[model samples]
Target: MHIVITGANRGIGKTLAGRYRAQGHDVTGTARDGSAEVVLDVTDTGHHADMAAQLGDQPVDLLICNAGVYLDKAERIDGYPAEMWAQTFAANVTGVFLTVQSLLPNLRASQGKIAILSSQMASHTRAPGGSYIYRASKAAALNLGRNLAADLRGDGIAVGIYHPGWVQTDMGGAAAAITVDEAADGLVDRFAALSLDTSGCFETYEGQPHDY
Candidate 1:
């Protein structure tokens, strides 16, 4: 399978890229710093265009929209700045949409599946008052994935939104519950299980359905 993973320089994206490559799949790992096969800053339209052009006619069997930001983490109620919200939304919500749009042709050629790494924090039921920007952006991403699933089903494309668990990554912190390998392993299985019949599902890395 030809897989495309954004934000692959580090964290879960990096681990997922390595795992897929170790499995002998063709993996295009993209990073903003050009540390991977492709250079992409998810919020940049030019980068998205360049990435699409570089792939040409190659079919992308899987597109993982793993790039995101959590700018307002732990911000006090009055500390949430407007710019933080803008940046967070740009990366977490608009970026996912742009990546999917840019790769639509390639995905269509392969009848691919899209896996969006959202978070349990995106669920309304999980709201705990912190990281408002991150939570809102992820929720928007979930909504985007669901609608994309509906629109792309006719093209044999499936979309699934996932909560990758509390992973031990730069974003998730070392104290987080799961190791990168555990999260990646479970996510790989979840990605493989995604199909038109189960498209638009919001699920955990462990393959359990999550509340919307």
Candidate 2:
């Protein structure tokens, strides 16, 4: 299997890359600084094109859009800045779309699975105070994944949105609920179970259904 993961130099994405590689899968880890096999800044359109060019006709069995930002993680109600919102959406929402679109050909060749790493916070039913920008951007990602699932079903590509548990990573913080390895292991199963019939589902890393 050929797996491509974005924002993979650190955090959950990094762990996923390592685990997949260990499993003997051809894993490509992308980072913004050209420090990875694929240097892709998800927010940059040009980088997406470059990535496609780099891969050429290689088959992509799985595309994980794990690149995201949480700029307003601790911002209070009145503290959310306009620029922060735009930056967050650019990375968390627009970036995911661009990656999927740019890699469409590769995915089509392999009938790949797309995993959008949305968050439990993306759910309207789990609304907690703070992290306004992160929450909204992730919600948009979930919406995008759901619609893409519908549109890509005919192409044999499955798209699923997921809330990787609160993991102990730089983004999740040390006090988070689960370790990076734990989340990655569970998510691997979730990704493996993805198919046309289960596309568009909002699921947790542990296989539980998440409320939209």
How many pairs of residues collide in model 1?
A: 0
- In order, the Cα lDDT scores of the candidates are 0.94, 0.94
Which lDDT tens digits does candidate 2 get at residues 26-58?
Answer: 998899987789989888999999999999999
TM-score of 2: 0.98
TM-score of each: 0.99, 0.98
Query: In candidate 1, what residue range of length 10 has the lowest lDDT sum?
Result: 69-78
Q: Which parts of model 1 have CA positions greater than 4 angstroms off?
A: none
* Candidate 2 all-Cα RMSD: 0.7
lDDT of 2: 0.94
**208, model 2: CA deviation in Å?**
0.3
Clashes of each: 0, 0
Q: What are the per-model C-alpha RMSD values against the true structure?
A: 0.7, 0.7
